[model samples]
Target chain A: MSSSSSGNVGIVIVSHSSKIAEGAADMVRQMVGNAVPLAWTGGDTDGGLGTNVAGILEAIEAAWSTAGVAILVDLGGAETNSEMAVEMLAEDRRARVVVCNAPVVEGAVIAATESSGGSSLAAVKRSAEEFYA
Target chain B: MHNVNASRAANAFAPLTASAVLVNAVGLHARPSVKLTQCAKGFAAKIEFALAPDGPWTDAKSPVKVMRVKAPQGATLHFRVAGPDGKAALAAVLALVHDGFGEA
Candidate 1:
């Protein structure tokens, strides 16, 4: 309900395959409804299997909220790219983002759900991290 | 641990308890699990769920714990709520369960 507010935490999904990233976002959207902010970016800009910091950075910016954003990446390169993307953010913004260590699909679900519930940044990150437990 | 949160309840207003069967073809899975966990969070009650009439009850508010019950079709889920809004919380969850989570 308060998602539009700055206190809302958003989710950014990154993967080597654009389909995988968008598909996971779609499933999370269905579960949490459209209220929770969500963004996904994957694949090379040329439409191949790879990741780019530019795309991942755009997703982080798009998902920005006062409550911060949690990143879920699908592969090793995606993870490294996501980290770089986080660093690209303004110092203040960078402090609010985190690369969650969990399965992308499950992490997206849990993060989106907790964000929809109006959880804090740390709480949402914890929920995403808990997916691995 | 039953008495761990005893003092949290206002009084012995009669905890609401109910049992429902899972009728949906896939039974308890991701979708239902999400819906159920969201439902459990709507109230201040401490909700616990059991797979059978006399089974071990775990916190229903936890998605992982709820999914661990492995409630297949025809499996009965027992829910118990204790708090000021226990009755209403129990009824809301029972209604969701009886509706097959709208998946049947």
Candidate 2:
């Protein structure tokens, strides 16, 4: 509903704790300040330390943009669920989603900044991957 | 703030050098590093940062490399700038560095 988050590359954060996912998103919002679209799903739909495929899918949908969406997960399980969400998307949407290989907090922040600059899918993912460097 | 590698104009006369002391309690950690990297990307120049004035400069435009420095508080980061908009890029990095990244 905000102009700041519209028309930019989007980001989805997946974490085992709603606090973490939301916190990471908030931190990014602080740094980038709504310059990029951001969405997140934490824990299970039941509010446990698990990821929900449907929730992940919905989060991705919330952050969707033609510029592309980058997903960052807190752990392996979150990663798996995120992948499933991508698979569950319509073929057209699936093509625009990428699960990044960066840590959740750092990756989300880095990716959001890159997205705010209106970068492409590959470039945002590349910046996230550079977390290890 | 010492100059390790002397500035040489990559073109006719636009090379620049700047320095800033890391003042945050943890040095150049996640938030600060990310802020610096984002600032570095705004220019087309070839900019680098290093702990030493004379050796081992890393690309300013790379978040990974900037994070790799693990520059702690009290460490002074020196910058080398060359190419188009090099002077402007150097000034921005130096200012951001001095800003302490809004950290304690």
Top-TM-score structure, candidate number = 1
Give lDDT: candidate 2, residue A28: 93
Determine the backbone clash count of candidate 2: 2
* TM-score, candidate number 1: 0.88
Tell me the tens digit of each residue's lDDT in model 2 across B1-104.
34335344444445577788998788988778778877877777778888998648887767667878899999999888887788788888888878788776
- Model 2 / residue B23 / CA error / Å: 3.5
- Model 1, residue B23: what's the lDDT? 84
Error of 2 at A90 (Å): 2.7
Candidate 2's TM-score reads: 0.83
B9-64 per-residue lDDT for model 1 (tens digits):
63465556789998888888888887887788777888888886565887777766
Candidate that would win on DockQ: 1
Supply the global lDDT for candidate 1. 0.82
Q: Which ranges in model 1 have alpha carbons more than 4 Å from their true place?
A: A1-7, B1-14
lDDT of each: 0.82, 0.83
The per-model DockQ list reads 0.41, 0.34
